[model samples]
Target chain A: MSLVFAGACSHAPGITGRSERADPKLREEFYRNLGRIRECLEAARPDALIVVAAEHFANFFMDNMPAYCMGMSDEYEGPIEDEEWLAIKRRKIPGNPDLSKRIICDVMQKIDLAYAEEWKFDHGIMVPLHFLTPRYDLPVVPVNINCQGPPLSPLHRAYELGRTLRAACDAQPERIALLGTGGMSHWPCTPDSGKINVPWDKAFLDSFIHNRREDLISYTDEEIFADAGQGGFEIRTFLTVAGATEGSTGELLFYAPIPVYAVGCTVATMAVE
Target chain B: MSLYCIQKLLYQLNRDPYTRQRYHDNFESLLEEYELTKEELGAIREGDIGLLYVMGVNGQILMHYSALIGQEWDEYIHAMKEGVKSHGPVRAGIYTLLKGSES
Candidate 1:
């Protein structure tokens, strides 16, 4: 069975982009947390990691779109602007094709869902990849949720999907870990752009790593969206992690409010005993 | 009220420069559309950037208001810092902040 590590993630714009300049303090904090994640990855040493996250208009468009999509390919790209970084391409971490096929078949049979054979990794996936595995050698099977568009999946449904994904990962003997990335809170644009939800962000982080799955499952999308601001809906990605964990405990590592970008960025790791 | 509505309003403000002036000229109408109270309108008009920050309005909305009132980029950034500082940190995505704040 795969061990799942899930928590709130912040996809700060500059951090995800090719910019070399960074807040020295923040950069140190990010590397420190990445070190911890690297340790966890080494200990688990899973054959594949089923990563759940959102897509940033890179794959799907305003036209034909799926509420949920999975990357079934053998390799994918990281977010880098320079042709050099792009040229030093990384292969899609191999996915358990048999397991992925089964999960897709089961999800389609059981629910009104859709799947995709190809998906390009966006900042949502890339930023974390840079931190989780800077060397870009780790293989990951990616699953993306469309949290931005209308008819978005509700919190409960997202959680349930995670649970289903967990079952699928477990069906295979290959070890796996799950990573969910996104936000704590921020409005995304306006004079008040860099606002962070100190109280709410902390509370969500607490509940997430502590295996408070019920609390997360019961949370309404409206309530989260209201408290966490517009970017808050990304919580659904965490729910996916919670499901994969099968309600296991997680450890909160870092929480920093990046004022420049208006996001309360956090990094956490969850594992099963 | 809803974050979606707030986001939609901000999106409109960022996309259209004249909307800011329209907001200033017909602040009452904007309030009616958003169903904001007098205090809310006053809060935004008086540059209560902190209160505005907590209200979850985005940069595009502020830019629209600033442009409508003929405020320059420097002035807009100043007001934004003041407002954002009032509340600690704003939660908007970094990309939006950079794009909206850039001259």
Candidate 2:
């Protein structure tokens, strides 16, 4: 078996984990999208999944944040957003340490990338993982991109990182799937956190799934930030996945502007030809 | 003055239990370690959402601090809305409401 699946997921626990009594429509649609990803994973039957996501100060802080890092731990700690209300909460998520270590060594040797032996899974990884592999049965290799502050990696560089990840995965024998999770524009921690840029999000989705716009991959961090807010930089996740599956076109499995989540929730699976 | 410093402190508190304990043990002294103005320190110690919102703490970091202090989700969110009324437009950062009333 080889690398069979690649996709991107939006992880805003506020929306995905909202109370049942809250906007029923948004919550229902959110899960429906999650279900779509789950179905794809089941169909692919990947032995291990590689999750590329940004850390929300869970594992590292401004003092020392790596540009890109892979977790080589046997098990990752928590959903980090440990508040009782947010629906997505798990004490620990299993990790494919063997494969994770393999990718780390591969990346370090091949791409000269740095890595950490331990990393806690925050909402970025856990939220999507909860939806993708709910039972925690499937092992995960978590990769974190620095989307927290400035000195961020360039968009194209993120894409290149994805390509490197693809190579690392291909070197392994287990059937592996790649998933990038974060952002469709809902700025968190800003006054506009309550807002969602529907048109911006649509354009991004259209470019990825329908139009196949090459230029979409080149959009700079400033460009994305100007259009979707700083949080939109999380789209770097999508860029990496797209870069890894360069020739493949994606199918939009889910799209909904969930205001409560303060994010334009979207998910898609790519079929590399 | 330094939103970064404010966030750094809060971020540490959010992630590290020991940091939280130290902060709880000596709020004033611990806060002094950061380069914060009186207004910012007061807002943080008092848990003044309005003042902190006006002071321009990022919501991602601020929301977790609110939770640590036992504020409900809706209340934490609303405090931000009320922050605009009580303190004024966001003082700085990405959330800073720009001119022309554009949020």
Candidate 3:
């Protein structure tokens, strides 16, 4: 079986941690859209869910940061921040090592990759899971791109990673759902945390939802920081999703610049071709 | 720059219960394990969120550290602002690269 569902969304900690701070109407709208996608994901009935996220140093540090990493564990735990801080309780999330090993092996054939037996879920995965897998029943396969550190893999490589992931998932018998979660254009964690570039985010989404490969990979890191701020580098995750569904367009279910959430809150899904 | 070590320390403190225990039990001894500059040492010792930001700590790592140390969301953002105001901008890391650029 191939990918049963393909989608992407934002995973800013503020989505859950500071939920009450955002405009209630906008938050509900954003969440309703998330619910829409969740319904779509469940309808697909995937055997495993692949979350391609940009972790914030929860597990991988710069000490030995792999450009790309995939989880290969029977069990994983997440929301590594204080329980009150993230507003998500810590729990042991189930994983399918067999499926992960198969995907990792297949992905490695085309691109250099790292496989981790142990992974701690930061908001990157936890926040999204809170909305999509509230019951936490689906087996998860976590992928991390080095969006936090410098010398990240080229955007094309991220795209290639996605392409390879699609192939790997296609080879397996189990149905899979792949979702990339990251901020669009916002500064997180600094004093400029609430700053958002709406036009920049919309333009990128336009390219992404349309699956414009060339335009998506054309951004330079310099340009991203100047306009989108450091947090914008997480575009790699989006790029990977776009790469997976290359030639297939996506649907933008929701988008709103929620300053308190510190991200242009987004929920979108791509057609798995 | 010992920035790497500084972040490494915070990274450990944020994720590792053992490290957090050491951080609570013998803070000084735990601090000694990292190759931190005097400024970094002072920043960690005082839990000066602003100074740490100014010293070029990545917000992703620093944010967790702030939460671990009990700084609320608004307080963390304010701390980074104060850090830039007092220390005159981030000295290194991604921020410097962004600030240093002609763009």
Best-fitting candidate, scored by DockQ: 3
Question: Taking the tens digit of each residue's C-alpha lDDT, what string does model 2 give over A52-168?
Answer: 898788887767778888878778777777746567756777788788887788777655566677777777887887778888888888888888666688877887887788887
What DockQ, between 0 and 1, does each candidate earn? 0.10, 0.43, 0.86
Sort by lDDT, top down from the best = 3, 2, 1
Model 2: DockQ score:
0.43
lDDT for each residue of candidate 3 in A220-251, tens digit (9 for 90 to 100): 99889889998999999999999889889999
In model 1, what is the error at residue A89, expressed in angstroms?
8.0
Which stretches of candidate 3 lie above 4 Å from their native place?
Answer: none
State the lDDT at B64 in candidate 3. 80
- For every candidate, the chain B TM-score is 0.52, 0.87, 0.93
Task: Show where candidate 1 strays beyond 4 Å.
Answer: A4-8, A18-22, A80-99, A109-111, A189-191, B1-103
Model 1 TM-score relative to the real fold: 0.67
Error of 3 at B17 (Å): 0.8
